[model samples]
Target chain A: MIEIQNLTKKYGQIVAVDNLNFTVERGEILGFLGPNGAGKSTTMNMITGYLPSTEGTVKVSGYDIAQEPNEVKKRIGYLPENPPLYTDLTVDEYLSFVSELKKVERSKREQQISDIMELLKITDVRKRLIRNLSKGYKQRVGFAQALIGNPEVLILDEPTVGLDPNQILEVRNVIKDLRKEHTIVFSTHIMQEVSAVCERIVIINKGKIVAVDTPENLSKAITKNSRFTIKIAGVKASVIGALKAIDGVKNVEVSDKVEEDVYEYIVDSDKQVDVRKPIFFAMAKLGFPILETKEEELGLEEIFRELTTKNIVVSTESDNSKQDASGEAPEEDDQAEEKEVE
Target chain B: MLSVYKKELRTYFYSPLAYVLSGIFVLVFGIYFLTQTMSKAGQGIAQIVFGGQLFFASFWLVMLIPILTMRVFAEERKNGTEVLLMTSPISVPQIVIGKFLAAFTVFLTMTALTAIFPIIISISGDLVISNTLSSYLGFVLLGASFVAFGLFTSSITESQIIAAVLGTVTLFFILLIDQLKTLVSGIFLKIINQLSLYEHYKQFVQSVISLKDIVFFVSLTGMFLVLVMIVIEKRRWSQG
Candidate 1:
């Protein structure tokens, strides 16, 4: 339902969105995953006809945004990062104004607004001033505004950013339900938000597309090494030696000491190896009881960090190496990752 | 365009700024009316002299029109609501025209309330119908031009205060261009005198309904409104 081709936005010397190419099928929820300053909002603005791309095109329902903006805008409903609300207007008044601005039919305006208000669960606060409402309510009202014209495509820029956890869950559920009828392109820095609702995730960083695939495929493609964490009641040296002696074990590092004679070891092995059963038998043969065992599969959070941080590390490797003389580049990388995630 | 016009009008009524500004406009006009009448009472002239009253009221436009128009586009940009308007199906010209008309409506309403002075004068003495009507026509045209200028200033900035100040200062200069005639001579002095808004407005006050003055106000208003539309359209491409 939507196609973006080489969509680039430049602010003088800085390129905010660079040759971004993507598509959204009808009734599909495409997740836009990126950290701060990742040009997600810039991309969304171009798609909604609010901003003109310096060089490229965005088409909605086969109409070019630059050539026929009104036709494209007619099919897309956008909720910007700030929600674009008039605080002095009541909920009903704001929605009514949006409906009119969208050129909804006069006869169906009231019913459509009520239905949207009901879907967003903002019916009770319909008469109250939007300024007096809570943040969550304001967000829902913003969402309700996007649903007013029943547009085919909805471009929401961080719909759940300022909401509470429950409100976030509620919004996710709403997005999930919206997939039955509307094609959704939502941007967020939250990993779980995309994993929970989007059919395909597009991870972008520094104005470029890093990875695009389903959540499962993205995780599976990046994690090529099988890792296991095991806790055994034996001397730490013996536990490490026995684990390394296994046929497919690549490396064994004692990560922590859980208790006396009980050490946790992180076991790395070849991707094709099933080392869990072998490690169990090896520990049993050594008279070392296995206290606990866990197969450490990479979660979406790690995959996101790995995808987004790899580029940063490559671009600034020289600067990073000079900054950290102790060869703790990995630790510094982790700190940089944390800052980006926050 | 109609939708935006209605929404803007509704917003004006909802906010207290419109009420306060309109109240001040009426109060000031009433005071001027009473003073003009009291001072001319000894000449047996019970005629409602609105030409002088409107000339004074034009000064109030320097203050009140900016206050009325400062928030038209500046507030939208500040609140991030410009995104909503730009992304809608409406055209930039439509939004500009809609807002221009909404502000014009409020100015008309404020000026309409001053008609009571003429009604009171007509009850006691002869009413100069042509002069009163021409003066009002000139005032409306002049006010529309100021509204357009103020709207243009509002479109250029996100801060309402800056919009108001810019609108007030530029408009003050435009209205008082004749005063600057003293600083120049020859071609420059003629240019300054010709650019004076008060010069064009004085013809209407004297009941001279020349097409030249009418065209000047209409074209000036159109030019400013077009500038507002261009500024809004250009921002879409230039904004980061």
Candidate 2:
């Protein structure tokens, strides 16, 4: 449905988006994953024909954007980062205006609009002014606006940015549902969002493509050593010795002390090893009761951080600290909501 | 183009700016009409003319038009709605022309309201219909040119106040060129005389419908509209 080749955008001496190449197959949900200012929005804007590329071509439905922008634009429904809303207009009024702007047929405009409003669950507030709505409702209206012409390609730039957890889930589900009919290119810094809804992920950093693969493959490719965290009630030195004595265990260290004589040991092993059962038996043989055990599978968050922050060692510590300060799951959501309110 | 025109027209009425500006325009027009007509009470009613009223009204446009068109493109850029328009299937020329027409419609409506002055004169006393109509035609043409200039200024900046200031300064300069023409001679005088908007406007005030003046206003309007489209297309490449 879409093909982008050698796409580049530069601002004087600064290159914003550098030599990107990707394609979205019909009905495929492709995730554009990157940290803040990773040229995600710039790439999306170029794809949607809102910004002209400094180099290369973006062809949507076989029409080159620079040469045939109207044809390319006709097949795309874009939700920009800011939602492109007119606060003075009502939801219905805004959607109707978008329908007209998109050149939806006069006969089908009303029915199509109502159906889209129903899909986004914004029908109830259709008559209300957009300025008076909360952030979540306003976002839904923006989504509804994008759906007005029923374009075959949907370019959503952080569609769930300011929504609460429930709203985010709802938007994720909407994207999941939309995958059946439209080719979607969704961009976000949130790791979980891409893993939840996108079939394939494109990870970019500092205006360059770092990794492009399935989420599962990306995690597997980055994690070469299997790691385990286990808590045992025994003398710390002996616990570490037993864990290290295991056949496949490469290294063992006391990660933390949970309580008196109870220490958490981080065990590293070969990739092919199933060291959990062996560690359990080894601890039992030493009469050191196993308090708890967990295999720490590297998640998309780690993969994202590893891929994005590589070679930028000076900034890695601060990025990790920032991620740690926000407790992982709802950090981006909370920060974005705070910004919306302000 | 029609879609943009409709939406822009609706936006003008949705805010209080249009109403306030139109009210001021009418108030200014009425004051001019009353003073011009009352001062010539000793003469016949046929001598009570709209020529002076329209000439003064043209100056008011140098102030009012910038305020009217300041938000046409600047607000869209500020609110991030330019993305919506630029990404749509509409061409840059279509968007510029649609916005120009919408602003022109509002100017026409404001000009139409002042027709009440002429209507009263026609009913109570003798009135020269051709003179009154020609003055109106000239005023509308001048306004169209001012609106196009204002729209071009708006397209170049994201700040509405800055757009307004740029528009007012340029329009004031265009109007003032007529006075400056007398101070120069030779080729410079010829160029200034041709560039002066009021110099072309003077013939219409005398109830003359010269095609040259009509063509001048129209070409000026077209030049500004084209400049607006160029600015928009250039920004698509140059804006960050």
**Evaluated with lDDT, which candidate comes out highest?**
1
Candidate 2 collision pairs = none
Best by TM-score: 1
* Model 1 misplaced regions, further than 4 Å: A230-239, A253-265, A272-294, A312-342, B181-190
Model 2, position A65: C-alpha lDDT score: 96
Task: List, in order, the clash count of every candidate structure.
Answer: 0, 0
Per-residue C-alpha lDDT of model 1 across residues A1-342, encoded as one tens digit per residue: 888888888776666776777778899999999877777888899999988999989999999999999999999999988898999999999999999999999999999999999888899999999999999999999889888799999999999978999889988999999999999999999988889999988877766676777888777777878888888999888888889899899999889988899988898898888888888898899999998888876888998899777753221222112221232212122222322221
lDDT tens digits, residues A1-342, model 2? 898888887776567776777778899999999877778888999999988889989999999998999999999999999889999999989999999999999999999999998888888999999999999998888888887788999999999988999989998999999988899999998988988998888887766666767787777677778888888999888878888888989998888988899988888898788899988888889899998888887899998898776632111222122222221221122232222221
TM-score of every candidate: 0.91, 0.90
Q: Clashing residue pairs, candidate 1?
A: none
Looking at model 2, residue B101 earns an lDDT score of: 97
TM-score for chain B of each model, two decimals: 0.95, 0.96
